[model samples]
Target: MGTDVRDETRNATSLLESNLMAAAKDLRNETRKATRTLERNLMAAVNEIYKRITALEQVLGWYRAGNYNLYKVFTERANYTESLENCEKYGARLAVDGIIDATILRDLIDNLINSTDYGTYVGLDDRAKEGTFMWLSGKPLIAGEVRWNSGEPNDDLGGGQDCAYIRAEAWNFDDHYCETKLNYICEKMA
Candidate 1:
């Protein structure tokens, strides 16, 4: 009887030890799972907050549209060179996206064509070689892809219309002289 009791006690202790070890492993795994879930939830919340902040920025007169960064329009008149310099000073450059050359600005602002009588400067020029236009981003402006105003980019009697200017009334590039002062658009990455 004593031997049987001793055997029973030993068996019970071994079983209890095994059960405790299994329980501990299970608890560790659960803790790890919970931690991962909490991390994911925190990341999702941070992303949502960022989206809300971006919306608020738009409400505060910042312009943004498809595939473009936040845009800042300067109504104050400035020449083409000055416009470039001013945009650079503010850590930006002239609006020179491939889409902008077409008709993206129209969607960016309602009635943008009729917004004001003043025209805007873009980061396009053929100063490198006459009749060879290119954007500041180093992308070539294929002539076939764009619509030029009546007799535009003519260099104005061989005076050389190197820079590109977009007249407000006309959505297309009616164009203007580089030396001419006008309102301009600046773009910074989002």
Candidate 2:
């Protein structure tokens, strides 16, 4: 009877150990599932925040300098023609060439576009006739009013760089091929 009792006790201990092991495994699996769900929720929240920020930025027009509102489209890149069209959608025009406007644009570009190795298209271009740069407002860019990059107005490249752009590091207008796709800035009257 004593042996029988000892055998029964050992069997009960073994069963308890098995039950504990199973419970531990189940807890571990549940913890893992909860962790995965939390990560997914965090990602969704982050994406929503990013979308909201972008929408807010569009409404704010990027920057307000003097009497004009400047907007730089750094995400979407397009050629000279396409850029003009895009600006039209926003009820604005490609940035024009004026002393104050150019200065404001240069400062904005220096802060934003300078870090990237990309260029931003400006409104000034000599597309209709070479060596005669004109702004989108039908006014020619007068010499000495605004500075251009050193050795610029070099329309000697392929197809002659007719479109003007503000380079990243230089922050000065330089002629570029009209067909070359690049980021662009838009201007609206405040």
Q: Give per-candidate clash totals.
A: 0, 0
Model 1 segments more than 4 A misplaced? 1-25, 28-36, 98-103, 109-114
Cα distance off (Å), candidate 2, residue 45? 34
RMSD of 1: 3.5
Candidate 1: minimum summed lDDT over ten consecutive residues — where?
105-114
Taking all chains together, the TM-score of candidate 1 against the true structure is 0.76
**Model 1 C-alpha lDDT per residue in residues 1-190, reported as the tens digit of each score:** 9999999999999999999999999999999999999999999999999788778867865566565576767888898899999999878898876335345665544533346577777788887887788887898887655556778878886665788877676655744677888887777766
State the displacement of the C-alpha of residue 36, model 1, in Å, after optimal TM-score superposition. 5.3
- Computed on alpha carbons, the lDDT of every model, listed in order, comes to 0.75, 0.77
The residue-level lDDT of candidate 2 at 53 comes to 67
What lDDT would candidate 2 get against the real structure? 0.77
Report the lDDT of model 1 for residue 76. 88
